[model samples]
Target: MTQISIGVPVFNGAKSLDAVLECLRVQTFTDFEVIISDNGSTDGSKEIAAGFAARDSRFRLVEHAHNIGAKNNFLSLVEEANCDLFIWRADDDLCDPDFLAILKRHFDSNPELALAAPRVKFVHDDGSPNYEEDFQILSDKIRPLRIGDALMGASSSWIFGLWKRDALRHALEITLPTYPYVWGWDPLTLLPPLLDERVETDANALLIKKSISTARYRWQVPAREMWEMRRAFSRTCFIAFRQRDWTLAERVIVGVYVFRFANLRVYRFWKTVRAQMREWLGLKRRQRRSVEG
Candidate 1:
């Protein structure tokens, strides 16, 4: 078995799949298998993945006849992975050649480490630099502080980090019940490992992410959907909080953190609502002026 399994869950990712695959092919660390899970894409994604698998012994393609939801596609990769170390690679993200090697070294040096992620550089679809983010979480031994730090500012990029397979599976089991919705899934899945105090980050190892204007998309979602997302986020935090064995003080601390996190989401939801209301009013005014003219 390979030392690591890199799972790529893709759907209509033809535009960037080739480049992503090339990045993996040239990685300085060579003992890893690439499992490409294609979600019935008609946009030539299947052929691109198949071609890579045909040429590289380390690459394998798994086909789904029908389009499974994105969440299911991600879970399928985890189920298919064979290595003790696993990571989910987005079809559009690029990693430094030494990314795997650096993270693997961290795990090797610290057997207790459950997850290791590098800092992330965000780029536009056209390959222009956007910004860089440090994968920040309090590395404190105190579980509440770690959970609070993660809830406040953990980068979603951590979801792509190299993880001990068992830690990842355990995290997913705790977080998946509330994960059917798209928003806020990453932070919830990341909390369990952070609470375990075994997650680490290296700024030198880099992941270049292709930004897709996700912030704008989130704002555009209907207000009702945003409320549903907020509910899911709250439920996830509650479930995660209950799953742990905590002292009374730890429970109270976690409760405070969860309160803050929920309030933050609620604030964002209201902001989105106001933005949409203004947009709708502007559109109405434009229509009235056009009619009068």
Candidate 2:
């Protein structure tokens, strides 16, 4: 068995999968396997993945006949990995050769760590690291407000992180089938780790990555998909609260709706238009801008 499994879940990713595969092929840490889960990709991803599998024993392919939902497809991918440590990477991203080498050593040194995440460096279209501003953004959120205080707020977390195999299984059990979250995987993955284990963050810019295509859970994804996600998000929050978490859960529920206030589609634009106009006119002090810009 490999020392770790890097779960790469892809969808119509032929355009960028090869770059990622090439990066993996040259990894200094060779004792790991790549679980390439293809979710009904109509593109050339199958052929690209097949080429890699033919040459490398570490590369394995799991094919889904139809576009199995992203969350379930992801679950299926992770379930097939044979290692205790699970590292998630988008198909279009690149990883530093030392990414796993450094992370695995930490696991070897401190066996109790259930999860860990490293500082992610956002890259421009040309692939240069956006080091100047990205780190600042990460530094701001690494210490988010206590979950309860942020209630009526929003709940979210970074995904390119390492997870202990067992921690993932526990989170899966809490999933609800409300038409696609399959168990609040997004919010579940985001918040549950904060409860069971302290997720470690590193300054090492090991996980080099970018999204080559729009995927559910990103801002540009469909609103229905997002609202569907919020259902799971809210449900997870309730579980977190009833399970005796004093602050994080309730606050997270509130946060998910509040942050997702517009996305929830609970309030009509015209109905809220008057209210929003009043707030806008009354408040000259507060403003929100697009963060990615």
Q: In model 1, which runs have C-alpha deviations exceeding 4 angstroms?
A: 137-143, 214-217, 263-269, 272-293
Report the lDDT tens digits of candidate 1 across residue range 193-221.
76666788888889999886634234555
Q: Over 4 Å off in model 2, which ranges?
A: 128-157, 175-179, 182-184, 211-232, 244-293
Q: How accurate locally, in lDDT, is each candidate?
A: 0.81, 0.61
Best by the TM-score measure: 1
The per-residue C-alpha lDDT of model 2 at residue 173 equals: 62
Residue 280, candidate 2: C-alpha displacement in angstroms: 20
Q: Residue 135 of model 2: what lDDT?
A: 26
CA lDDT for candidate 2: 0.61
User: RMSD of model 1, in Å?
Assistant: 5.8
Let me know the TM-score candidate 2 reaches against the reference structure. 0.69
